[model samples]
Target: MVKIYYYKEDDSPMTAPHDSGEPVAAEELEKLGVFYKYIDSQASVDNLATERQYKNRDYITLDGATFPGGEEALNAKLDVFFNEHIHEDEEIRYIIDGTGYFDVRDNNDRWVRTLVEKYDLLILPAGIYHRFTLTDDKFVKALRLFKDEPKWVALNRIDGNTESNEFRKEYFASLSS
Candidate 1:
């Protein structure tokens, strides 16, 4: 079962639990326009993508720089992933295996950490400020789905450039309603 809790602010590593352990209901997440679903892990990826109207898809295995550039590259990637950012399109990720955390900002601008496991599918509305990190195992394999050509861009919240974005404006408006 996927679960969410309030995130604890601390100087611990990104992979640290940093969990307040205070559970948050699924409806609370949905109220922020963050949708979730669960598809059998054995289900066909192509079928799922088609049904969801996803135009492009790929797999990413995050297991300590096991791909290409080695540990240094993996470190760089983690830095990017852990940075609070927003996307121009809905960010969809399906956990194929392992576990990870997706920390999303709530209406009150607090962190809500959700632990995602196998078969879990998260559909984060476009422009939602969020970030991700792996659990202590430091491993997770996920299917990344996109509506069009993959947008691998992340407008980091620290830069203050995401405020005027159209998708972001629309997302915030939906929250008020």
Candidate 2:
């Protein structure tokens, strides 16, 4: 029952823009199969506490759960460590609380800034260079699901320096300004 929305090779999902809001409903989530889930932001904190019960709950490699690491991991203050450039095999995210923006460079070289808030699910395919920054509010908590067993790849760390690569330069330049 997974719903896969494929963009044309010329139109990348990255760089697409969207408004922030509540998580997608359970029925919609079920259709995504193991793709993603946008945890409801309006849910009481007590209800949100049971997020872990859904861990490893699906057969797909991209199983996701909101607030996976708990409130401490999510509520921590935002820092540069949180500002990162990543390109993954497949990136899936579910917003559990707060709001943020994801800047992505699509295959067509178009830049899209997508505003995400509670309950918004975002999925990005491989080879897209992207980064995230805190919203003006500076508070965000979400579940990140990766198709790869070990989900994140720091391009700066892998490539050694952001300046050495053209893609890195473009990525940083786009996000910074």
Candidate 1 per-residue C-alpha lDDT over 63-102 given as tens digits, one digit per residue, 9 for 90 to 100? 8748568766766788899999999998998999998899
Q: Lowest summed-lDDT stretch of 10 residues in model 1?
A: 40-49
State each model's CA lDDT, in order: 0.88, 0.45
Total clashing pairs for each candidate: 0, 3
What are the clashing pairs of model 1? none
Whole-model lDDT, model 1: 0.88
In terms of lDDT, model 2 sits at: 0.45
Q: Mind giving the per-residue lDDT tens digits that candidate 2 earns over 78-146?
A: 333334455534456666666666555443443345566777766654434555655555556666543
Which of the numbered candidates is closest to the native, going by highest TM-score? 1
Off by over 4 Å in 1: 41-48
User: Which numbered prediction scores highest in lDDT against the true structure?
Assistant: 1
- Residue 169's lDDT within candidate 2 is 51
